[model samples]
Every structure is written in structure tokens, then in C-alpha cells.
Target chain A: MSTFAEYAISAMLIIGGVFTLIGAIGLARLPDFYTRLHGPTKATTVGVGAIVISSVIYFSTLGRGIGIEEILITAFLFMTAPISANFLAKAAMHLEVRTSEKTRGQTWDQ
Target chain B: MMLTALYITIAMVTLAALLNVYRLIKGPDAPDRILALDTLYINAIALIILLGITLKTRMYLESALLIAVMGFVGTVAMAKYLKRGSVIE
Candidate 1:
């Protein structure tokens, strides 16, 4: 691989790794379920997307033709993550999970 | 340089997975645990893809894909069961 390609892949990997770590930290430390939801849905999805795109570039440059699998997974992930998050939040609401006092939304009755 | 970056990324992703596990174990609510498991699967997918890249093989891709499909289904099922009393009703 060319130096430019190597550099690009490295940068993508690093960005992906950093965002993933940040999202995990947010997930672990956030005060409530709703607030924690923000982390994995937004940050981790993008993080995985970036990393997969790098993989696509790497494999394509390796002369085996473009690997469409990575792209497909990224798309699939983007589609499913929000749906799962929505339902999980709904479940939390149904169960009357506690929310932090600083949270602005009023709790819903089951 | 590339090798070093890959090693660093792997370490960071592993750490992320560990944190997710911590959340999974320490959840104060069921949905919290479910969310942690969802995030953990996603992190596992990332780790598999990274390993594939590092080892320069495509075999890991299929496993990653399978995990993605199963993880989504599992999350949805568990979420439904949590929201309602049963997964199918």
C-alpha cells in the first residue's frame, strides 16, 4: 500500500477507536438510561462506520476488488441501532426506570 | 507505524468492551443491561473487523456479520419482552 493510503487507514482506525472508547465511557458513566442512550447510538455507530470504511479501503487497495461486505454491515448497523435504542428506551419507560433529576423530560406513566 | 496503530486501536477497543461489560454487570435497571449488551456486541463486531484487517484475512467477516444479525434480533426480542410481558403477544 502507498504511504498515503497507510496514513489514511491509520487515521480512520484511530478516530474509530477513540470514538468507540468515548461512547463506552459515556455508556458506563452516564447518569441515566436515556442519557446513556446518546452514547452508543451516535458515537459508536459512527465509530464502527469509520473503521469499516477503512477496512473497505484496505481490502480494495490490496487488489482483491472492493469488498462490499463492510459497507453493507455499516448500513445495517446504522439502520438497526436507532430502532433498538428506541425500543430499549420505551422498555425503560414501561418499567419506570429511574432518571436523573437533571433530566428534563417528565416521566411517563405505565 | 501501521502495526503500532493497529495494536493501539485493538487495545482501545478491548478496553471499551471491558467497560461495556462493567455496565452490563452493574446495571441498575433491565434496559440498562440490555443497552450494555447491545453496545458490547457492536464492540465485538468492531474487534472482529479490526482483527480481520490486522491478520489480512476475510474469514472473520462472516462471523462479524453473523454476530451483527443475531445481536440485533436478540436486542429487539429482549426489548420487546421488557416493554411487554411477553416477546410475542
Candidate 2:
């Protein structure tokens, strides 16, 4: 409700929104599937996490007790993102998704 | 000031979601599209939360939670199907 709280919320939202946009841009522009995977997991996770934290701050200061629901969502997201990313990477491997030649890595089972 | 910032955030997030849609449609691979789908849902959750803050209501929270759960399950299932050619084996 105070000006400082408003500013804090605004700052968090801006940071979160910008990172999210960058992640989506990476998704659209990256040449390799594996490279594309890095965008959402890294940037979007932080982005959404900040946004959720801001939500917690906003609601908690709104004269209510601390909010735990948003925290739960944030925790859930952090947990599942890596698992999903791992699965997607595995699927890409099984399907033999193309990789850019510039990619350098130890030999994978082909 | 806060309202203006909220509006800007909503615009930015919507643009991001649109970009995700472009990747979803233009995917050069199945996993690329799936990744786009996954990001889309995550963005949707962010949007819902932002909207809740803007509207000062808690009604959307449950839907956001449900989306998170369902979206993760869907991603895992689709990934498994892609990896093994069937979801259940």
C-alpha cells in the first residue's frame, strides 16, 4: 500500500517480465533444440520465481497473513522444470533431433 | 504508478506468450514445439498471477495452480511418448 511497496512490486514485475520475454525470444531464435531448452529453464524459471515472490510480498503486506500458496507454486515449478527438461532432452535424443554442427560435446550414443 | 507498471508487465508478458506461439507453430522439431508449449503454460501462470494482483482477487489462484499441475503432467507424458513411442510402457 505504501509507495515503497509499490515500487518494489513494480521493480520485480519489470525484472520478471523482461527475463520471461528474453527466454521466449531465445526459444524462438535459438538454432538448436538443446540450446533452446536452456532459455525457459534458466530465464523463465527465475522470471516466474521473482514474480511469484513479488506476489507473496504484495499479498502479505495487504494486511493479510503470509501467503503460502504462491510459494508452493514457485517450489513446484522449480522442481518440475528440471525433470521436464530432462525428459525433453531424452526425447530429443531418442528421436535424434538435429543439433547445430558448432555444438561441441563428448560423443553421445548415436 | 503501480497500475501503469502492471499494465506494462501485462503487455510484455502477452508479447512473450505470442512469441512462444510463433515457436510452437514454426517448430523445426517435435521437441521444439513441446518446449514452446511448456513455456506457454508457464507464461500463462505468470499472467494469471499478475491479473490477480491487478484485480485484487484470489479467484484466479486456483486455476493457476491447476494449470501448473496439469501442464507438467502433460509435458512429461508427451516427452515420454516421444521417447518411447507410447506414454504407458
Q: Stretches of candidate 2 above 4 Å error?
A: A106-110
Off by over 4 Å in 1: none
The lDDT leader among the candidates is 1
lDDT of 2 by residue, B1-89 (tens): 87887888889889999999999999989999999999999999999999999988767888889999999999999999998889997
Predicted complexes: DockQ each: 0.88, 0.87
Question: Candidate 2, residues A22-89: lDDT per residue as tens digits?
Answer: 99999989889999999999899888988887788788778766667888889999999999999999
Mind giving the per-residue lDDT tens digits that candidate 1 earns over A1-110?
Answer: 89999999999999999999999999999998999999999999998988898898899889878877787889899999999999998899999898899878587856
Q: CA shift at B17, candidate 1, in angstroms?
A: 0.3
